[model samples]
Target: MNQKQLVVRHRLRELMVAHDIPSVQELSRRTGIYYATLLNFYHNKFNTFNNRTIATLCEFFDCRIDELIYLDKKELCGA
Candidate 1:
């Protein structure tokens, strides 16, 4: 995955942790995402995820796409 993608994934997980969510199960309950699909996101096992998953994440996290996921070129240089 690209740096932006990796950063987004890491940030999302950090947000979840900050909220004291101990498991993906809690996120699934809040976001209505299946455990298996959530695993995909948690592990960054795929290069791309479905639009539905993205939308759900945005809604449940109370964040815009740009907040939860951004295409930050600066991340590439470790800036």
Candidate 2:
């Protein structure tokens, strides 16, 4: 079976800039998410994350999933 490469483009940094959020630490506090987890998401270092986490982010930011994460197929395929 062939597996499709899926890349998650984290838009947290962009949102932070637009919203004037000081740091990931502040986001963590406001969202009740772990600082390290937020850092991982900010850096795109996490291989996998749970839906609950995503839900929390969406709720906190009042944004949809598309605004937070983008699925880049071209980058995944190296096109």
Candidate 3:
């Protein structure tokens, strides 16, 4: 049987651009989230997602959960 893995990707940068947010610092100030935490999400360097963070982003951006994060399936090396 073939194996697959689902990876979650963040759209923070795109959302920021669409919303006319200038910088991560500005976003952090606006959203009341830490710069480092938002930066991690912006660069997709996170392994786990926090419910509060996701809710905060969705509320701040007026976007859906799907819009904030999406899934990509990749084939495993061995099936």
- In the range 1-79, model 2's lDDT, one tens digit per residue, is 4446766787898888877889999999888899999988888888887899999988878899999888875333333
**Reference-based TM-score, model 1:** 0.67
Model-by-model lDDT, in order?
A: 0.73, 0.84, 0.91
| Backbone clashes in model 1, listed as residue pairs | none
Off by over 4 Å in 1: 1-10, 72-79
Better of 1 and 3 by TM-score: 3
Worst 10 residues of 2 by lDDT: 70-79
Instruction: Write the residue-wise lDDT of candidate 1 on 1-79 in tens digits.
Output: 3354243343578768767778898899888899888887788676776899888888877778776666533345453
TM-score order of candidates, best first? 3, 2, 1
Candidate 1 residue-pair clash tally: 0
Better model by TM-score, 1 or 2? 2
TM-score of each: 0.67, 0.81, 0.85
